[model samples]
Target chain A: MTGSVLAGFPATTIRWRDQLDTPAVVVDLDIVERNLRRGAEFAASASVDFRPHIKTHKIPALARAQLELGACGITAQKVSEAEIMADAGLDDILISFNILGRTKLQRLRALAERVRLRTVADNATVIDGLSSAFSGTPDRLGVLVELDGALKRCGVPTVEHAMDHARKVDRAAGLRFDGFMIYPAPDHWQDALTFLAACKDAALQAGLDPRVLSTGGSPDMVKFAPDANVTEYRAGSYIYNDRALVSMGGASVSDCALTVHATVVSTPTPTRAIIDAGSKSLSSDLFGLSGFGMVRNRSDADIFALSEEHGHIEFADGAPAVGDHIAIIPNHACVVSNLTDHVQFVRGDYWVGEQRVEARGTVQ
Target chain B: MTGSVLAGFPATTIRWRDQLDTPAVVVDLDIVERNLRRGAEFAASASVDFRPHIKTHKIPALARAQLELGACGITAQKVSEAEIMADAGLDDILISFNILGRTKLQRLRALAERVRLRTVADNATVIDGLSSAFSGTPDRLGVLVELDGALKRCGVPTVEHAMDHARKVDRAAGLRFDGFMIYPAPDHWQDALTFLAACKDAALQAGLDPRVLSTGGSPDMVKFAPDANVTEYRAGSYIYNDRALVSMGGASVSDCALTVHATVVSTPTPTRAIIDAGSKSLSSDLFGLSGFGMVRNRSDADIFALSEEHGHIEFADGAPAVGDHIAIIPNHACVVSNLTDHVQFVRGDYWVGEQRVEARGTVQ
Candidate 1:
């Protein structure tokens, strides 16, 4: 109510006597800027254009921060999300997911009219649907064939399927076959490169140039360079390292920009404590994690379980007394961001500002 | 943008055309009302007051609707949530979470001054903290001793510890003893009830009447009702059936008032389809569930994996085509509601409206 602990207020500006509400989300802008610079520098060193995925933060201010730090573009997973960024003046978006449904396709076409929009598809049916939806449109729509690396979620299983989809995409008049896209499975860079080479061979056989090969995944981005046949990097969540990223040795807790600032509400026993943040704020995606997530300062504590609004913490060292506020780097950053409308930005001891999660609730 | 799909609209006017969007959450108001009425009626039939916990929906409108349907008071898990609901002019709130920290306690004392605020504490430290914060204040802060069930989370482990803390709270000048509160562990209801009774006996031994006996849970509500020991019910998620509740046979999918409407983006193979609704929209809390969640109408299919913004559905019954929409009942409705800003409402083929998740970011 006092707006004292609101996001973006400089921590240095507050008196030590001021109270900090528990279960609040805290974002370190210094770490966030460093992370952005590090990721952009990595892409620059690899000779690939850095187009950070905005889905992780879903805040226009953060997107602008990435662009100001030299990001070539931004990637979105939905037309509605893209529209949200586009409204905030972010153009050149690569929609990472396949766009379907007449209503959604209509929205995407409208968005393409406002911004340079690119998307992915793994089959001819989707391409045909896009073609039908964009008939008589003069704006060029970039198309990418998604490749499967180690994760078996989306994309074509093999290079042949990728080529088949690419060729079919080429055959569609309203759609342009630009290149290939792959969401790497568990940081398997070697498999992804091998798959990309196969895609190049198939494209060559079909007499098409796969000029815009995009490979993305924060875990495997370091191993992926231009020589690996990747021309663009679409890594997201790198600006805010999470527990999964830290466990995979991609980033450290110090590099984690976003943290759930939870207070110890109850210390029922010497070994147990409960925090106010739960599955809702911290998220339930384990990402193959051993526990709930990583807690800063209290690394010995394990998050045993999360109810809707309460998190059960088990510590081996000592239980945190009631009123202690601890930082938690979630298992996944993107999902955590989706649960809130805004986050506070802090610099060292100063909490300087706040930013709304502008693209939140754009579910369409 | 069409008002039909926009977030924060009132729920009395949604349209059928909005279902084309993937991963959009929907709540059935009729079923929700039915669930509320049934729960309140059952509580009345058993001669108990129903204090419907609003932590599940986090919407003041929904909480107001519940109050109109016979709920004694609304339950909140955070001071910020209670403050927001109170700001909306709704009073008689029970802050169900343990209050900690100086800044937070100051805020809690401020809140107690505004409404009939009641809260729980499990330790002597918190009781002393509250006493210090509310020193010299004439307002009475009702204090409940949170007793441990089989959950092993927050609460006093033994009856002696509970009574000892209760006596300390009774001696506090600014706080009033208000009985006991327990979040009963599923399958351990009888034992917890017996422990609570023993704690009450100890309270009586200390010359205190623990008149307020609050016990409730989505999984164990039915089991706890017959014991006649719990004088108040504090259930929340029973209003919206989720995978966990459905699996526990607490409510059916038809009784489920919450669902995510997702568009099928890709049908790459006969056995696989990708949807727009993923963990960001539907949350990944399986609650020991076998899959991510359950898809309605497409019962044979399985929602197996989520990648931030994409849900992978595997089916031997053949793939859903691109552009098709499907409904999903998340494993945990409370977490899913926390993921988005609002939900669409529908009734018998008629598109009704939208409702804002008023308490979405009230982490404190």
Candidate 2:
């Protein structure tokens, strides 16, 4: 018989079957709500405005749920994502990134008309552009001076640089200087705090009130929060702890909210098992992870290699038999969500069935 | 402003108005046709049957084009993929993977009732499973022994081991031993040739005529084709060359057909620019790539880092200004295709516009 006839495997089963589907995305919603409330409660307990970032969870539904629970507002990076949230009535949004170009600025203006929109700037050029577009316009835009600590990704490296941008923002018309923003490097808490303190002193010297000081990375959340100086805690992925975070000892496997359902397609030997979920589904985004991800309940197994559509699981112990389904908690949850159009949310066992990753693949 | 919000900044326009309504798996039809022809022609010139593997490009329309161009049939990894092709009325399929478990065997039995199917077996247990399932069946199963040349992925390591499996298949009821199958390791042409020679001797020793000696792998296709010993050639990625293939000097940037359409969202620094295509859109699958992908036309720029929702492009010469649209050829095209439901196909000047990745996220 030809292979074509034998290969009529099912995608409908993934969409409809109670179980036995290969390469499926699963999320634990109960853990997600708990993760949301934890961050919001932490913000309330710390006595600061809790503007939860929606970038981690792009689903507008999740963003709405967070706002309903106690989030001050939602945060977005792209005008597209922000627009989606705003369209869904997430009116108070901080673009959180520099808004540039006439096209984006016009979109931002439209968004500002419906919401209290703010963006971050590390230099005077961006501030000038913001001022040039919005000056004498009815819509007001809030600008935050980005102070970089050790993370060389973005922002001004020092308090002096941050203050210079802050002064320029204060002088620029239609641009409101709202305070400071900093994305700390891994395990550099003391340095981030020191930079924040310096920014506070520089802002006071510049005669501008620094209202908000935000810091959050799911890994460093516990260490940075409860500080009298830090204003808000913005942590996502705690809602869906992945292998990377689990490896860092940030969260337990039981707390993880997302997992990939994959079937063992080939058990070539006693050591290597080829899985249906490869770089495409489970994702090859390893954040210093030893493997692609960890198979839940199978600690000894390692996802050593990945082809485009196949994951090669190497086990020093024993390989999984062909047709056996393995649940993989990815190294990162957000990327996984973005790859799938929808993810199935199940309450108990895998056979318990599906729900939509309603926000899956919402890159725009 | 929260860090999550700051990170959510979309570098490009999120025009919901321009959104494609129905979810579809998009193909750059022009490139796909070119890739298919190139592969088919390559096989024809080499005097080998072009059994273009349908695993990479799963769409039936593409397969039809390949078959019309003189492809012997198609090689499928999953039963579902084969089933789709079968529904499209194309027969002659070789399922490249080992078939296991009773549920899968039952499915195979049903598939055999429809079309010509050949399957590979690396061990005796799998051969037994196949024989037991099709004992009284009229449709004989063509069985090939998977040989491990150098990739060490699947297959038996030695010729003796492969012959052992082949013997089992020959002894099994309603099963016919075809020949041998080898997936060569990258840059290991000499080792592959040596193994193939050994396989030839082993097949003759086992008193079986090696009519169809199959050797596949895109990277080493040229190395194997010139030898004329291999009867069948299976190559998939040559249709859509990715960043990793380009890096290997196997294909040129022009030959690389697929690209991710992205916009510059955050210009945090003069050197660092953030794009709207993050790991979700761009994917974190590097395949030994230095970064995520190549920003088409920007030779000096390197996508050095990627977060779940952010792609960090470090420009050695100059950064892209915010709002600039950039095209990125990902490290792995197949995985990237699996990530998105559709991709816009643009001709020389974007005149061709966008198309849906119709079977994009079919993991089941």
Candidate 3:
């Protein structure tokens, strides 16, 4: 249970296909390396520092690869995931979520000791928590004032709130007001930049030395420009583009590095076929995709329904037979990465090795 | 990592909260035991052979509890789950899925040697795989022909297909055609029973002995009558009934045993609060519920949106503050059970112990 399952996998017809069971996750190193290189190129062309959010693929190897490809650091949502990446020898990290609670903050404080740690504080509670955790520490932790963007999930709602939070973080004993973080930069990147610029101007006028303005949206990352004023970008799903990315013109279908290789278990109706991947395997994160997932090489099939262990595919043109292997590009690659313990690695169609989903099921 | 995370859990004013990290899964043992006892009592009154599906909990202790409460056996959806239960000393287990592929079949054969292994077959491919795996064995393995119900995910489509598959299973070497299986026995379970009876009539007319008809739907299982002709009832979600069940009037909120304890990390807006639990903790499965989950105690807060690590809860009246602890009963419990390695066990508000989710990520 602790190690990679290298043996007892079902055999595949492809000469070097790893015998991973159905609903097996496979990450093609070819596409991954290419995607990483392209991301670096995009960042260099845009004059923005690249720091991938490790929440996409928690594999330590991928984080190392990103650093080797000129990534400044990595972003994680949890202290536990950051701890894993830290243990893997990535020195710089930014936990993008609001780090709250005593246990998490205590762990965050310890993590700060080992790495160049930075985190975001959208509200006063988070700032206060950080202040308590690091008040007496030798090195103050860096805090980014998270500004609300298109996603509307987290962050300060307005420049007024942002200014207040930034000032609060700066006044905190154990924190440094380092930068700004605008998440899901959206297609309207210019609008976000305008807001960020307003926030930055306020910070500068208030005599605050804001070091970076980190912004990210996988679809908008490539559209970023030098005058965008964002010094750093964090993209989680860019490396393993999924169906959502392809549809949004973020990446091509072939650019998808991770795919679920599922076997058709039942052809219940003439138009309906059941695959082995379901919500448990391929997550139920539709993320605006019309279906559960997009089947590779089967444009006619629609993965219409999903249960715990079955994905129903309805097709008119391509009749699937039971035991037929199919590849699926999930809607969101990040959620899929968190499902399996380890993903089978492949180069093209040939099985190479396995990369463990190193930080999977890390609750904290 | 194999053992329970018993250290460094944040202290709570509530004694013995098990200190599981936020986005922690805590199942109430009192409710679980009551649920188990009620399920046994239902089986006795309904006059059906009880086989609680371990797919819901996938905890060996829960399976043993079910057996201790008079369950003739336990039902699992995957061979690997059955293998895990077998390792836990559960002898009679029915894997109620089409077990296909070479490795799965070989493992199924190995599992049959240790337990009274049973499975279902909806197609010729699955039947052939079973025959190939079990052929030359001393004893025949039990197989129930799956009849497609309202779920339309899997199962033989028609009575003829069910009879044909059942006869094929009977003819195959080292295979015994035990009964029928209809999934999602709907509100109109009589219709599914009608279909099962038709398939049974065909088998009986062909001089075949169909001993049991396994019908299961968490909601409809209670509506089942003694005259259902179904000798076996396999209810998966009855143990930890979720929001879906509560919404469907299958069970009340108090009947739900599993609840996610998450802390409010951000109150970004007056009406919106963000919790640490998200798609990674409470799965993105919206089984007809409007939002991600229903918040416990706070009836006003609507968990409307969920990202990978943040659940955005919007409330008009709650005015939730940051650092507030909220328990959410997810829309679906089975998917949540798979997202965690182990769950905290409690009697009520006080955490007592932990139970390892023994068969999580079992691909086969």
Candidate 4:
């Protein structure tokens, strides 16, 4: 049986890959550093503070490498995640999520005391909760007014509503209206830039200091122009491209650093084979794509379906035999980090070691 | 804010529920016990060995409860998962997936010494590995020949092939051909029973004992007839029903014991709101269903889309307001267990403390 699409890696890496336990997540540090350097260079050219979201890797070491590569700060989606990063010595973090509830607010308050922390608020309820917990604190929490740009998931629907929330944030106790943020949708750059400009103009007219205009979505990071209105870009999936990112026009498969290593456990039919990887290993996030993931270097084969412990593969010819190890590039890279407890890191000819996903399930 | 769909519970449970952090998985002990008893009673009536799959909860406590409630053994989907259960003192485990690779086979050998461990193998390659690892041991490893009856996954395709594999297991050293296993598809019980009967007759004619004729898949277990040929039934998702189960006619919404606790984080528009629970929390298993999950007690709202940390809700008349707490029965409950580190167990008036998911990502 052929080794893998990564069969071209160093013989040491190749042999090491073959020896790994099946259904393993392998992250190539060589590719990771290359992707990080590219993102840092792009951010430098665009004059935006690059805050690489740690949701992709969830490893403190990778977060530190992102910072060392020129990110001003990092972006965490949950307070629990930000707390983990803070415990690992990451000082500056922008939790690009709405912080709510009393117990979580107190913990968020504690987290803010330990780091240069910031968060987003799209409604008065969240702002009120943050105010109640942090009103008497010495350091006011930085708040970013999230706008309902093209994504339209969690943000104020209109600029008027956004300005209203911005003003409310400005007047709220123990909270400073630091900036604007949006997890903008890809393929709508013109409308997104327009929305950001209008929000910035409205903030200026209201005599508010809108210091940061952050826009993010990894696919559009490639289109960031020199004169783009946003001051920061948060790209989570850029560091490890997946089929979603590649199909979304962000990066090619060659740039993807992470892959799920699996073994062919069965060939049920002449044209179909089964791999040990499934929804638990390669997550079941389909980006309107045809299959769950792509087998490395096998355009003739694609993973068709995934049960809890088995991945069904349909091939044109030469179905892989049982016991042949294969590597799969999952549809989404961010959630893959959450599915596994640890990820193996490999350099050119040596095993860098395994890193536990520090925030694997830090949903809260 | 209205408390939750669980508002009908005692004031203590409601108060305790309100105190929980958002995006938490709350498992009702009352409902869990009820579901366990129902599954056990059904299996008893069918005269089959009830081996509840721990892949649903991944908690040793739940597995113990299932065993105490009449489950002869427990079903673990992977060898790593079985190892965790064994470490937790589960005396008998059936890893219903194929066991392959050197490292995993070695661990399986060690686990067999600790517990009565049985596993399924569909091909000669897997049987060869198991035989090599267990040869010369005092206790031969139990092997179940799997037939691809309906759920065309991890099983041999034809009865002839299954007989061949069964004979191979009988002849293989240090391995006992214990039974035949099939994860049959629902709504096709007649064909499934025919296939099972054919395989059983073939084993008898070949002068081998297929002691345990196992047919599983929770959906079809509901239709277990009095004359069902199977000796054991392995049901994984019967413990915690989800939207997929309820919609598939295997369960009802009231039978679902687990719900994701989330707070309305934003009302972006009159018809749409966003909740703190997203794919990271609720998971993204659609199972041909329209939405991600159902908002408890609110027919007016359903979650339509999910981002990494945002759930988009589309509502009709009374859209949920910001800060309102709601519970969501996920599309699939098993995957939800795998997504979180701990699950909050609650009874009528008591808030059972959270239990860590012992093997949340035991997909080796």
Give lDDT tens digits, candidate 3, residues A1-364.
Answer: 2222222223334644446678789887778878888888888898888999998999887887788778999999899999999999989999999988878988999899899999999988889999999999999999999988867588887899999999999999989999798885456677788878888889999999788898887888767788556889889888899999999888999899999989899988778889888888889999877999898898998988898888988987855899988999999999998989889877776776666899998888
Worst 10 residues of 4 chain B by lDDT: B1-10
Candidate DockQ values, in order, are: 0.60, 0.30, 0.73, 0.73
Q: What lDDT tens digits, residue by residue, belong to model 3 across residues B90-128? A: 999998888888888889999999998889889999899
For each candidate, how many residue pairs have backbone atoms clashing (under 3 Å)?
A: 28, 35, 0, 0
lDDT of 1 by residue, B1-364 (tens): 1122212333444356555355678887768777777676777776777888887888887787777767788888888889998988778888877887767788888888778889999988789888888768987689999998778778888988888899999999788999999887878777777987888788888899898888877676655454556778788898887888989988877888888888777776778888888777777888888889898887888888987778889987998777777888888888777777777666646566666788876766
Clashing pairs in 4: none
The B-chain TM-score of model 4 reads: 0.94
lDDT of 2 by residue, A314-333 (tens): 87789877767789989887
What 10-residue stretch in candidate 2 chain B is worst by lDDT?
Answer: B1-10
Q: Global CA lDDT of candidate 4, please?
A: 0.86
TM-score of chain A of each: 0.94, 0.90, 0.94, 0.95
- Model 2: per-residue Cα lDDT over B73-100, one tens digit each: 8888767667778888879888887776
Q: After superposition, how far is residue B317 of candidate 2 from its true place, in Å?
A: 4.1
Scored against the true structure, residue A185 in model 2 reaches a CA lDDT of 71
Instruction: Give lDDT tens digits, candidate 4, residues B1-364.
Output: 1223223332243545657888889998788877888888888898889999999999988888788777999999888899999999998999988889889999999999999989999999999999999999999999999888665567887899999999999999999999798877667666777878888998999899989888877777687875546888889898988888888889988899999989888888887888999998887888788999999898888788898788999988767889888899999999999998898888854686777999888877
Instruction: Residues A218-312, candidate 1: write the lDDT tens digits.
Output: 98765655665878888888988888888888887789998888878788888888888888788888889877888888779999899767889
TM-score of each: 0.93, 0.82, 0.95, 0.95
